[model samples]
Every structure is written in structure tokens, then in C-alpha cells.
Target: MNGLLEDARSLELDRLRHDVHDHPETGLHLPRTQQAVLGALDGLGLELRTGTALTSVVGVVSGARPGPTVLLRADLDALPFPDGPRHACGHDQHAAMLVGAAHLLAARRDRFAGDVLLMFQPGEEGHDGARLMLEEGLLDTTGSRPVAAYALHSSASAPAGQFSNTAGPALAANGTLTVTFHGAGGHGAWPHRARDPIPAVAELVTALSAVPARRFDPFDPVVLTVGSVHAGTRPNIVPAQARIEATLRALSDDTLARLAAVAERIAHGIGAAHDLEVRAEYTAGYPATVNDGAEADLVGAAVADLFGAERFLRGGRPALVSDDIGRVLAEIPGVMTGLGACPPGRDPATAPGNHAPDAAFDDSVLPDGAALLAEVALRRLAAADPAAG
Candidate 1:
């Protein structure tokens, strides 16, 4: 709706979103997605570089005057489902909005005094695409790392056109918890000849499930869910081993570590009670996304200005979902905010959320998202060092 993103550009953004949605690609090897991005930015006259380790694209737009650099990022990956890959997370919309921002910034480069680094990343689901881009020199593309960065993510369960974010701990830290119980196997008819691991496995599950409530403080929350449980195929036989896999989420590093420690201790203690062998593996994942206080204020102001003040909300609870952009924010000062794209006629409370097979995002928010991203970049760049008139 802004003058920067006109009707024609908005239509093109929708087209691009639909095109990308139709052919979704997961993980780091996204050649088609990368090619589509390059084609969209063909005549921007900005310096561009493709990823060597993964299919990432970094573009730099320099102002005629000198100032600090700011980074704008958009992830370009999809989550796979039972049938195939789908843009259930609305990553297609994220990429389109970034492209729109690139166009708007490229056209008005003379109005700002700083450089804008456009980062189009892949493998955000779990492969750490942002880390790979950093390894391949994403920050140095502009000759210096950015002073501040910003990224926007879409939500399928929020009111359309609403912008929400928190100043600190915008998202939780993610990790995995796996526990395997080992015991001796014997004939089902035998009389207490073998130690059955099934009882120990059940006890371990109960102990791990009760960890957050019984072990940690009530104010400091943690979530541990056992998503998978595996044991013997036949019902009659006593299995030699049983396994349980769970996902771990916490708001801080210390809490995450504590959660893992408690789970492992519980499993080992239960194994000792049952006189069986037990092992636990904790695989670390993305860190918690913490926003800089100043940068978060900038985002709130930008959202309030670009849209109405009513559209801007603050101090909401952070999302439990994880993102690799946290990796970048850890290294630089940045803020990652969420844009509401819930489809029309869907209630935010009852609608399918992101990563769900039926999740849907409204394309009407495309222009709003694009304008918001461009406006944030413009405001940040202008505040860095005023241009000489």
C-alpha cells in the first residue's frame, strides 16, 4: 500500500510467492529457488554473491554517501511432509518480501546514506543455513559486518497485518533428547529369567515428562515432549532394549542444560532401580533468539509508522518454534519480528499453525510485509549517518 511498493510490484510479489509455493525445495540444495531469486534481482545494479557451501544469495546495495551497514535477511527453505515438500512455514512469502525490499531499496539508494546487505538463506529448518552463510563470508560482503540486522517471519495464526515481537528472548532454544534402555531378553514363558526393559522405559518416560514441573522453577519454563517411543515389534516377547526420543525447548542456555542434565539423571537413576543399562544423548540445536533492546524499539516504531499504531503490539509471549536466524543475531545486534499472515476467514486461535499440513498464509499481506521491511532498512540506514544534501 506504500508508494515504494506499487500495485504492479505487489502483483509480481504474489506471483513469485505462488510460483515458489508450487515448487517447494527443502534443505541447503535449493538451485531453483536460488535461480528464481537471482532472476528477480537481475537489474538491481547491486553487488551480488552466491553461496559456495549452500545455495545462499547475498546482495549489497551501497549508497552514494558513506555510513554504517545494515543486514536484511529472508530464509529460502521448505519443510517436507508425508507427500512431499510444502511451504507450510510461509518461507515463500518471506523470500518474496525480501525481494520486494531489495527493489524498493535499490530504487531509492540515493535517499539513504548507508549500505543494506540482503541475505537470502536456505536450510533454516535444522541445517543451520545462516551459519553456513557466515562461514562463506556473508558478513564481509559489505566490507564490514553490519551494525544492526532485521528479519521478518510470517505467522499463520495471528491477525492479518499485525506486527508482534518481544524485546528479549523472542524465541526458545531448541535441542533433542534421546534415551535408550537396555536389558536382557528371555522367553515369554520363563519365570523372572530376564529383566524386562519395558517397565524401565515406561518409568523413564514418566520421569522425563515430570522434569519441567518437578525440577525447574515455575517462572522459568521448559518443554520436553517424547514424540517417539520404540520397543519390540511383537507383543508377546520381552524386548532387549527400548528407545524414546524427545524434543527439548527452553528460554535460556542454563535452563536448556539443566533440563538435559535432569533427564539424563532421571534415566540413569531409573535404570539403577531396575538393574538395567540406560544411556541418554543430548544433541544441541539452535540457540534462543534474543533481540537487542534498541533494535526492538526501532522495529516497533517502524511498524507503527508504516502501518497504524493499532497494528503494532508489544510484550507478547515469544514463539516456541526455533529459527536459524538466531545464529546470526547472536553475532550481531538484530531483531527478528513476526508478521501476521493468517488467511481470511480463519480464526487465529483455532486455525492451523505454521508447519502444519493445512497451514495457509494470506497473500494480501505481501505488500505490507514488503513495505515494512523496506521502511525498517530505510529508517535504520538514515539514522546511522545522515546523507549530505
Candidate 2:
């Protein structure tokens, strides 16, 4: 562990994590969470900028000597469930750890070169916060665009304190799928005369569900989940239209596109077979998060050095979850790694996973996460211009 994460600093990080967790905010409207982050970062001698569009906070820490720039990002939004707002995704820990990194890097600014841009982003849940920041000049904020970028996410289903990452395609791309079937409305008792759209919609759902297996290669994974289906409003009257909403996930861009195409084809064919008009719309979401090979290697090495080789896991299958930080990786060469935050004594396999309402994150890993992120920035900056040290 880095000496910078002393006992006092660790305690402070824990407090920050818990404090943020207690007051979870969702989406781009996180005013309280943004204020909390700014407050924690108050004393760090950084040039701070707040988002004009969303409530994002970007802090820049310049080293004593000149060199290349690097970005370290942490998302600041929580997921909003039907019950209310929740931090089941562990974004509170992300913000706390990044703030901790900012403190460590700011204090040791004289030891390294280049500037560290701390990105505390909002709306990462589904609102494309990173893209909004980019539109508002995230790259231009530091004067020199970052040569590399890094972000760490906390996983509740991994062993505590362990670091895991994949070199290519670290996360899947996400897209929304909507399919509607239109038919004639009539009394439910006279099914033959009704030409019910509900049956066609159900058939389409089954066909859409089978698309990944029937259309694509088994090795190239695609997940299509029909989360919602709506058809009839009353038992006596058959509805004129039925709709289905699903989420599409794929590890590659080509596969993502192919999945959408196959879904549309299947829907149209099924609707045509039943003499129903089918309308399908696929909206692309975040792109797959592809880590730069060298940067991923750097992350592995940094984790191995700071913690140990045993704590580092490599070359695993990419996560199916999507992150808008993929937007940043798409623009620059960088890697996003995961730190295990599962509480002690719990089997990761059985523990509640991220986005689960009951999901829990171990606060103990906050210091480790902070140290690892700071070390990555420091190492990258040093490697960029070693003589500047």
C-alpha cells in the first residue's frame, strides 16, 4: 500500500464514503452530491471548474515541472429505483476514492510532472454525463488534452481489495430496443374476428429472445432482455397496439449493430407472418469500453507493484455492464479497472451484485482504490517525461 494512505487519511476517506452514501443523488441533478465532492476537494490546490450543463466538477492539479497531461475520472450519480434513490452501484465510493486520489496527488505534486485532471462526473447511470462534459469542453479544460485517462469502478461481487481488468473490450455497448405491433381492435370473446396484436407481440418477443442464439455465432455473445410488455387494457376489449421494450448488450460494435439488425428483421418477419404492422426502433447508447493495450498493462503492473501480484487478475471476459466513461476511452488511450469492494467474509459469487437494491460496498477498499488511482497517474506522468522529475 502507498504510504500516502495513512490511518488518518483512510478514516477520512471512510467518512466521506459513508457521508456520500447516506445522501445518494441520481442523474445530472445531483446538486448535494456535487457540493459534497467540492467540499472534500476544497483544500487541494487545484484549479476547479463546475459544469455549466450538468453538476460536474473538474479539478486540475499541476506538477512542479512540465510534462504530458493525464485524466482520472470518477462518476458521481446513483441509480434511481421505483422506491427512491440508492447507491447500490457504489458510485459514492468512486467519488470518495477519486477525491482521496486528488488529495494524495496534490500533496505530492512536487514529486511528479504534468497535470492531473480529476473528473467528478454526473449522469453516468444512463444520461451520458461524460459526453455532455466533452461537449462543454472537458478536453480543452486542461489546455493540453490528456494523453491518457483512467477510471476505477467498485465491484460488489469481487473479492475485497483485488484489482481486475481486461485489455480489450472491458465493457459492452448498450442500446435500447423498442418494438410495436399494430392490429385491429375487437371484443376478446370474438378472437377470430379481432386479429389480436397481443399474440403477435408475444410471438415476436419469443422470436426476438431467440435471435442471439439463432442468428449470431455462439462465441460472440449478445444479450437481449425484454423488460416490459404492454398490450391490452381491459379483459373484454382487444387492444389495437402492443409494445415491447428491451435492452441490447454486446461486447463489440459490429456485434451490437448486427444484434439490432437481426432484431428488426425478426420483428418485421414475425409481424408480416401474422399480418400485423411492426415498428422497431433501436437507439444506440454507450459504446464498448476498449482499453488501450499498453495502458492496461500499465494498470496491471501498477496494481501488482502497489499491492502485489496476487491481488491482480488479468485477461478476464469483459463485463456486460455499460459505462459512459467508455466515451472518454473512445477519445483517448486509457483503461478503466475494477476494485473489489465486497464486504469481508461474504462470498463474492453469492453477494448482491452492482445495481441490486441490497448491494453493499466495503468501505475498507477506499484507501486502496485511491492509492491505486494516484499511483497510476504518477507512473503515467513519470513515464511520459522521466527526466522532468
Reference-based lDDT, each prediction: 0.87, 0.90
Q: What stretches of model 1 exceed 4 Å from their correct place? A: 5-11, 386-389
lDDT of 1 by residue, 273-355 (tens): 98888888999998989998898888899877777689888888877778988888999999998999999899999999999
Off by over 4 Å in 2: 7-11, 386-389
Best candidate (score: TM-score): 2
RMSD in Å for model 2: 1.4
Model 2 poorest 10 in a row by lDDT: 2-11
TM-score of each: 0.96, 0.97
